[model samples]
Target chain A: MQLHYGFDELKDIDFMAFIPIILPFFAVGILLVLIALIDLYRHRKTRKSLLMWTFIILFVNTLGPILYFVIGRKDSERL
Target chain B: MNKFIVLIKKEFVQMVRDFKVIWLPIVFIFLGITQPIVTHYLPSILGALGGGQGITIDPSMTAQKGGEVLASTLGSQFDQLGLMILAISMMGIIQTDKANGMLAFILTRPVTVISYIAGKIVSNYLIAAFSVAIGYFASYLYVNYLFTDVPFSHMITALVFYLVWVLFIVSFTTMISTIFNSQGIIALISIVFLIGCRIIVGLSTVIDFVNSASMSKHAMEVLITGSVNSKAIDNALVTLVWIVLILFVTNYWIANKKFNHE
Candidate 1:
């Protein structure tokens, strides 16, 4: 099987033009995933499903890190 | 008043340590920027796919303005995803304290139930507000560059008016958090209620008057009309009443709930 759109078709795409637009999204997504990883590693005891959360945050793109932020970290009972 | 400041400070410190200080705004900024860039590129993306699949493209689908782009930042992004994040993030505000024995400890002090709950709500709401502002402003800057300069005053007005809706969201989630023991229940109810408001409000004017989600539509209207609509004010007043009612109920719930004291 071949890729649906070949490199010849990709020639239509202006890499230089698209790079500025795509870069911000990539930077934000990667940064957020890294932060998610750091938080997961730090809170392994309090947090549930270290492996699951790591993968979710790492693989799921924009919404993944958000899901991690919203639901991942275990809230401590003690103040 | 002193106690409120102290409590607010404590809550703020916790927020910083939780990394909420960093994640919340950055995520929103990403979302704010993402919606426009994606929507703008959608035509080209589809065009590329269309050629591969032998399909035609619609010109109208790609056509949009700076105002609409700015509006969708709220209409689509903040209204849907942002609302969910707000609900889930604040889901355990009081429940966590109750679960961990902190609620009981705090109560034994001179702090009123009102003050304690107020402190939690205020601090979280401040973060939500800051996050939204940064995200909204960043998106607006991109919109100005990519599309055209939207009316500066009108955009500011729309945001300020839209913020009433945000206030309701933050308070509503905090109240739901206060009432529920399970974070699962809290997240579920808050999301369902907010989403329900969006669905039902547009169906009837009576519902619209009370629906905080309408504020987003009204906010968009301000940009399109180039002036704040009176209805946005009316909706803000009604939502303020709702916010007060939610907080009141939350205060009552907190006062009565049984906590584990260790």
Candidate 2:
């Protein structure tokens, strides 16, 4: 009942093994950018702020896209 | 009752007008369809890139076998679904209201605090439930079409258990949203809580009885194996308690405090 991808197996990986691991992260990053762009177009006044968030999302990696979607986007909305 | 209905209608109207309803279902459906496909295809997709390194890619090994695919798919979806649906939905609702100074106006209406809170919670729950249901159905259809020899009964049971789990998560997110006025803080707290719960439950294996009470632990177990035991019941009860506690606190906040737009 070893229910996880063994850490031992993952640790013994090479460059080839890294691609799949990074794909989801990259996809998520792309998704964040799309969302930011869409929101920017909708709210023209906040285009600069939205672009700033898009950069943050691209640079932040693992949790960055999620943070952008949840918190960062909310920051640009007119309150 | 009329006021409550009116409040619910108001919430639904705002949700539709803002297009929050559309994005939620789209996200859930995307996660549902892609998680399994991505997980199933990742290794083979990587191998096809023709790296110079001698990486022997066995297609048989790459595709999940022996029923593990379902488990991994369900488990990953459960973990991700909370952040995607629950936290994101809460942030959309609460932050939009706070940002537009709509909270003050809504509060000034004839609607009672309880009614307003109830409307918010009920509508959010419905949206979450609908999204999860669509995702579950999509996953089921995809799996049935792509593979055979799946234990259909077990999959059905797992789907039912997962729906219950989603309810618990939605309720928990609603409570967290009520406690925090800022969307950033709410999202931060929700992510922290999810990670913390997983770690604590993972630690329970060495600690014996301690893991038995963890909600995420029970949820993962039920979701993967399609089995429900007393511990899962206990976890459900704990989640219910949290929902009630949060509602009480939210009602108190609304009654005693006035919101000022910053």
Error of 1 at B234 (Å): 1.0
Model 1: runs farther than 4 Å from truth?
A: A1-13, A75-79, B52-56, B256-262
Off by over 4 Å in 2: A1-79, B50-67, B81-85, B95-100, B149-153, B205-226, B258-262
lDDT of 2 by residue, B1-262 (tens): 7888887888789667545565555456555656556665555455444343335556454554424455545567746654554666575555466558776688888768888778877887787778766765555554444443356666665555555556555656666665577776776786677555545655654442332225444544554455655665655665567667778876776677534524
- Model 1: clashing residue pairs? A77-B100
Comparing to the true complex, what docking class would candidate 1 get?
acceptable
How does each model score on TM-score?
A: 0.91, 0.70
Best candidate (score: lDDT): 1
RMSD per model, one decimal: 3.8, 7.1
As a whole number from 0 to 100, the lDDT of residue B22 in candidate 1 is 90
Model 1 lDDT tens row, B1-262:
8888999999989888889999999888887898778777776676566666634445444566788888888888988888888888888888888777787888889989888988988898899988988889878987887776899998898888878888888898888776677989999999999988866757888889888888888888886667777777889888889999998898887787634333
lDDT of 2 by residue, A1-79 (tens): 2223333444455657556545543464466456644654576565446666656756765345445544554545664
